[model samples]
Target chain A: MSLAELIEQRRFVGREFLVWLWFESELFEGRFSLDALGACELWLEGQITLVQEKEQSRLKGAAPSSAPEAHEALRQGKLPSQARVRVTRGELEYAFLFNADAFALAGVKIPSVVKDAADEQFYERMYLIEELETLFTALYGEFLALRLSAAWETGVAPFVRAWVRGEPVDVAAYQKLRGKLAPVRGAARSRTTPPPAQAPERAARVVA
Target chain B: MGALKGSISFSKFYVRGELPDGFRDRFAERIQLRAFRPLTVEEDAEQRAGWCSIENPLDCELDHGKIFFNSYLNLGLRTDRWQVPSALFKAHFAEAEREHLAKRGREKLGRREKEELRAVVSRKLRAQLMPVMKVVDLSWNLEAGVVRFWNQSPRAHEGLAELFEDTFELDLVPESPYTAARELGLTSEQLAAFEVLKPTVFHAESTLGGAR
Candidate 1:
C-alpha cells in the first residue's frame, strides 16, 4: 500500500490509542510509573471531544472524561478524537489538548521555567515538552505492544469492555496481563495472531 | 513561532534521510541563502514564505550562532502577503479607473484595461501600506530528528515543509499513528500489525449512545 493509503487507513489506531490510554489511566487510578520518568499522574481534564462520523460531543469541565455523557458517547460508538490532558510529576504540571488522530499536542501549558536567562528558558521549555512527549510515547508504545499481542484479545479488550459497560474489573488481573507486555522497542518475538472472531469487542460495535 | 513566548501550539514532523558529513556549514549557508526577504510593491507575487531568525523575525540575517542552541537548530518561518482590503481596494481602484479614463477621454475601461489600472492603483496604495506578516518558529532537535513547527495550520505546515525541504535537503513526515509508532521504536512485527489494526469497541453489547 502507498504510504498515504496506509496512513489514511490506519487513522483509527490514533483514536484507539487514546481510548487505551484512558482505559489504563482510569484502571491504574492515574498513578503511572514508566521506565523513563519514574512516577507521574496523568488524566483527562478540562475538555474532551468524541466523534463517530458526523456526530460529535464536545464536553468541557474539570473532568469530562469521567462524565456519564462520555461513557454514553462511548457506548454509542464514539471515540475520543481530542482531549485536554493534565500530567503532573512532583512539583511540575503540564496540561494540553491532545489531538488523538494526529497525535499532536496543542495549547500546551508547561511547568513554569524558573531560569533567569532567555536561552535557559528556551532549553527548559524544550526539555519539558520532550518530557511530556516521552510520557506520551511510553504509553503509546505500551499500547501498541499490547494491541498487537494475543493478550489484547484474551485479556485487555474484555477488561475494557467491562469498564465501558460500567462493570467492576479485577485490577490485579489487569496488572498481571500488563506485566506480560514486552517493551515496544525490543526484538520482535513471534506470536500467533488469534482469529478476529475470538475477540468480540474488536468485531462488534455498540449500536445506537 | 513560540520558542520564546506565546500560548504553545504546534504540529510535529519527523525528519527522514541522513544529513551529509559536514552538515552545519552547508546547512547554515543554505539557511542564509533562503532567509526571509521583505516584499516589494513592484513584485507580482502576493506572498512569500522563507526562513528568518527565530529570535527576531525582523532580523533576517541568519548565522550558525543564531540558528543553533545546544542540540537544537531553530529558525522562523515568516510569511509576508499583500492583503489589500477589498472595500478599500475597490474604492481606490474606482478612483484610479475614473482618473485614467477621464485622462484618456474614454467613457468606459475594457476588462484588460481595468485589470491593469487596478494593478497600478494597488501598487500606488501598497507603497503607503505594509504587507500582512506572520512568523512561526521552527525548532529542530538534531539528535532526535524531530521538527516542532510552532503552528498547526495546514497552510503553515505546507509552507514550512516546502521551505524546509528546499533549504535542508531532507523530507519531513508529520507525526501520525504509524510514524509515531516507528519513532517509538516498534518491532518489525508490531509495525506490520500497525498496518491492519482495526478500531476497538469498548462496549460491544451496548447500543450506540445507550447510556444516555
Candidate 2:
C-alpha cells in the first residue's frame, strides 16, 4: 500500500492502543513497570471521549473512563478517540489530552518548573516533554509487542473482551500470559522477532 | 506562550532528508526571503503566510539570532487574510449596486457589472479594515529531526508542510500511528503489520440488549 493509504488505514491501531491502555491500567491498578522507566503510573482521568462515527459519549470527572456510560459506549462499537491521561514516574508527572488518530498532544501540563533562567527553562521543559514521550512510547511499544503476536488473539483479546463486558477477569492467567509476552531482550519489540508459537493459559484481573 | 514557556499544545512531525553543510547560514538567508509581507489593497492575494519572530509576531526581519536557539530552530508561522464580514459586504454591495444603477440610469445590472461592483466594494472595505492575523510557533530539533508545531488544525499542518518544504527543501511526515510507530524503530515487518491489523470490536460483537 502507498504510505498515505497505509497510514490512513491503520488509524485504528492507535485507537486500539488506547483501549489496551485503558484495560491494562485497570488490570495493573494504574502502575506499570517498564524497561526504561522502571516503575511508573498512568491512568485515564478527566475528560474521556468514546466515539463511533456520529455517535459519541463525552464523560467528565476524576475518573471518566470508569463510568458505566464509557463502557456502554465501548460496548456499542465505539472506541476512545481522545482522552485526558495522567502519567507519573518517580517525582515527575505529566498530564495531557492524547489524540488517538493523530498521535498529537494538547493541553500538556508538564511537571513544575525547576530552572529559573529563560533558556534553561526552555531546555528543562523540552526535556520533561521528551521524557514523557519516551515513557509513553515505551508503554506503546509494550502494547505493540503484544498486539503483533499470536498472543493477542490467544491471550489478550479474550481478557479485553471480558473486561469490556464488566465481567471479572482471572488474575493468574493474565499475569502468566503477560510474563510470556514480554519483549525479548537485545531486539526490537516489533515484527523483527519471530512471533510466539502459542499462547499459554491467560487471565485478567480488572481493577475497575 | 510557545516552546519557550507556559503550557504546551502541539502536533509533532518527523523531518526527512539530511541537512546539508552550512544549513544554519542557508536557513537564515531563506527565512528572510520567506518572511511575512504585509497585505495591501493593490495585491490580489487574499491571504499570505510566512515566517516571523516567535517572540514578536510583528518582527518579520528574521535573522540568525531569532531563528536559532542552541540546538533548536524556532520561528512563527504567521498568516494574514483580508476578509470582509459577509453581512457588511452584502450591505456595502447593495449600496454600491444601487448607486451604480442610479448613475447608469438602469433598473437592473448585468452579471459583469455586479461582479465589478463587488470587487469595488471589497477594495473600499479593505482600505477601512486590516487583515486578520494569526501566528503559530514552530520549533524544530535539528538533531532529532522532529518538528513541533503549535497549531494542530489541518490547515496549519498543510501550511507548515508546504512552507517547510519550500523553505528547507525537506519533506515532513506528520506524526500518525504509522509514522510514530516507525519512529519507535518498528521493523519493516512490524510496519507492514500496521496495514494488516483490523480494529478490535471488543464487547461490541455481542451486545447486551441488541445490535447497536
i-RMSD of all predictions: 15.3, 14.3
**Residues A1-208, candidate 1, lDDT per residue (tens digit)?**
8876776777788888888778778888898766445678889999999999999999999898999999889888899999998888888799999998888999999887766656666776777787677777877777777888866765678777777787776787777777888658732221122222231122221232
What TM-score would each prediction reach against the true structure?
0.90, 0.89
Give the range where candidate 2 chain B is weakest over 10 consecutive residues by summed lDDT: B203-212
- Model 2 agreement with the true structure over B1-212: per-residue lDDT tens digits: 58878669999988999998999999999888999999998777899999998878998987777777766788999999998999999999999988999998999999998888878889999999999999998989887888989888998899899999999999998888777777777666666665688777786443222112
* Global lDDT of model 2: 0.81
lDDT of 2 by residue, A1-208 (tens): 8878877888888899899889989988998877655889999999999888998888999998988889888888899999999999988899999999997889999988776756566667777777778778888878887787766775678788878887777766777777776642312222111111221211221221
Q: What stretches of model 2 exceed 4 Å from their correct place?
A: A114-117, A184-208, B204-212
Tens-place lDDT per residue, model 1, B6-69, is 7889899989999888898899899999999999999888998888888888988887778877
List lDDT for all candidates, in order: 0.80, 0.81
Best by TM-score: 1
Q: Could you give the CAPRI-style class of model 1?
A: acceptable
